[model samples]
Target: MAKRKPAFVLGAILLSLSFVVSACGGTGNGNSPASPGASATASATASASPSQAAEETAIPSASAAAEGTRSYETDKGVVEIPAKPQRIVTDYYGGELLAVGANVIGVEPTAFDNPFLKDLLANTQDVGYPTNVEKVLELQPDLIVVMYDDSYEALSKIAPTVHIPYGTATNIYETVELFGDLVGAPDKAEAFIAEFEKRAAEGRERLKGVVDENATFGIYELTDKGELWTFGDNAGRGGQALYNALKLKMPEKNSNDNQTLQLSMELLPEYAADYMFLTVYDPEKKGEALENLQASAVWSNLDAVKNNHLFMNDFDTFYRYDPIAITEQIDLFVDMIVERTEANKK
Candidate 1:
């Protein structure tokens, strides 16, 4: 998600259903749902402990099962979602929604852009970016999952709209379960979480031999503005796999930031690490970005660049940070690391 501007829009309270949305400011001891974790720009990783982490997935209070709907707690408020949501139109979390057996009929541009999702949702209709009120209403989603409140009031007229703020769930594990619970597929969520962790474990084992325990990794992106940005552990752009799954150490500067930090060409050499994954956001601006960096005597001379350690990646593929996206990213990154390491040995 390179400078991701979430476009999950259009939501409203459904008719004949009582949706208890979290009030702006609530009582200190009220039964208000927990505050949604902030976005990458302002949020820190408030990951709960293992036991607490499981609980933080947020337990939903059951209601009206006879009506084929359940009262579920969301980052925003208590939502009345269909027990088996047949037609879902969501924004950023489409990948997670699909994972939890959601029958997604429509999606926003962000979800439609995800490589895996693009193919899976190929037959689906696009709701457009910033979310068109007309398209969402036309799609006729039984459940509308949005991250922002922008279109809530407008879309509420058509469906049961639920808001789950972006970056609310800290990790893929919590994210999957949260959606699973929302769509009444907890069994699938648990199974997927267990399997996903297993995949991470296997990926970790593969790197143990080839990648040095202390090898530093960094995620670099060339922006449309012809700027360079380096991301840290939780900043997406494959950071989850690079830092979390593989446990690769990031540069000391980034290890602390754990988010994105801009770098001037002169300063990039200082931030370049043992391994770097570079993706250009817009190829049209690559000359001004990567080419200029390559021409920079100070930057090109850096060991990471000269040693062929800075691998250029496709922007669209690299920027999709959903669970499905991250799964594929892990394999690609591991192969790249192993290939680079083998070449270094020679």
Candidate 2:
């Protein structure tokens, strides 16, 4: 008998899992749910200042609005949503809703493998993909929380739908807080947000002595087509935890807004950092690409590669933008950085 590798064990559990297009809408667009056009006036709101938005919409006690439906302003305009929705259908943020203990009766199957949502959603019905308006209607949900623009109208006909602009938020905490208000769990949301902040602060303090303040980090993904992709802000691929929560510095080109940037192999050096995390969607294709890059003089000369600071990240753990996933990402990132920094000292 041999000691089992932890990565192998984790990979075995996640090997059968399929990657969904991140609700935060990262690059490569392959796994994203299709959004057929529908005539709904509600659209995803543009990325607003989270602090300002939070100030405007204070989290009220769950009982404060318990009597009846209330008019809530959403990206789709002011629509009345149940003050305490019993049956909720969420296309993208099902895991986040379940984290706050919302009564989610239906969800997209893509979220089925989410470790955080595994037990909670075991009995929930699959409402097909986000584009399956007919399946969603059959569920007779009291509220529909959507992330895409085109699915709004069709679902709204079945129930009031709120559109949360995917990949637009600046921080995960703000998004969680907003979702809390939508699902009538403001207090729980706030409590989670506070806990996230406290943990992030503690991690930052703990890493100050381990990680160099000036050390820069870079995140990239290789698609099945062999293209390179980078993310920013609320976009997927752990941007919120690595750059925002942990306060790690990133290269200038990678520090832009909440959008994914595509890069060519020739331009790899421009975005290379003191540390790099590479994600691969298709093992065979991305593995070939990784091998080719390893042979390149340009890649060989990069600071991170030469210093052995490159890490391979899994899609399931690192690609999520929700609160529960973000918390996990923060811890993982801190541990990696601390371990690497300490190893370098020896």
Candidate 3:
């Protein structure tokens, strides 16, 4: 992926994640799901499409007839989708639409900086973040793709929105397929999933036996409160990807905070894990940010720190569930961690 400018543009992507944890994480993986069986639960609107595409420009929104056909099950509920849905609006989950050959009429603009979505961003309108219903409705989207949360109320006012809470997919490909079926773009979705799987398989082969598979890893974020907060299995960023996809280990004592924790600056050392993927709060404040975290004695004494196995990941890639960016980041992460760990043993 090409590097993004202003550097902080990437920060915007990472900052967008705070909303993901809050708006998306309600039904923990263990809970019984809410009923998607309600017909009133879905509403479909209409939007623009490419002339060259196989599907028509203005198909029905998912809300029109909830009884027709459902592509797949989702965290929010069953994603009853229209076959060949047109005029899709998405937030957070851009890659899903792209895979299914669905032309995006609009998506939350901030997700564009992901580099993977640059082309899509150029073609579609930016309706602000997921909950910015005013701008989204202006596009007249047939379906608004969103993570299920407090934002659902506002999105419902705009269109027949599909709410897929995060954590439905274990990896990038699974994520793509889950969303693709929801929008009736399964063929395109499967193609994208195939490409991602190929890349991941290649990466796994390259890194195999290079690092200890049993070694634990940690996913963390920098809060506006100026503290480094550690994330658990089902919470933020790499949470689901790490636990479900990579199958790596984690520290024994982990908390279940759907909300981002504010680990005070003094407790930086508490974040130590076998491998630490650091997400800085603000890239502009890097000098001071690194200094503050480094001042803690616990930070310096960690095994990963002493061996220099820590990775400073882009906020957008590490802190949120953007499938395209996450796949790229995972490959980069596997390569670095494996190389570093093997070098340490030597």
Candidate No. with top lDDT: 2
- lDDT digits (tens) for residues 1-346 of candidate 2: 1122123212322232211122341212221122222112111110112222222233234564456998999766999999877778877667567545576778777677765456556667887653588888888888888766567878888988888765434455545556667777665555555555656787798788776778888887666555677665445567767766788888876645424666776777887888999877664553676677678798789889888798888866676656666665787888887887778779
* TM-score computed on alpha carbons, candidate 2: 0.76
Better of 2 and 3 by TM-score: 2
Q: Rate the local accuracy (lDDT) of all candidates.
A: 0.60, 0.62, 0.53
The Cα RMSD of model 2 versus the native structure comes to 11.0
Global lDDT for candidate 1? Answer: 0.60
* C-alpha TM-score for every candidate: 0.77, 0.76, 0.66
Q: In model 1, where is the ten-residue run with the lowest total lDDT? A: 18-27
> Clashing pairs in model 1?
11-152, 12-156
TM-score, predicted candidate 3 vs. hidden true structure: 0.66
* Candidate that scores best on TM-score: 1
lDDT (Cα, tens digit) per residue for candidate 1, span 213-291: 7878888876656667776554456766666666688886664233566777767777889888887765355466667
Name every residue pair that clashes in candidate 2.
42-76
Instruction: Judging by lDDT, tell me the better candidate of 1 and 2.
Output: 2
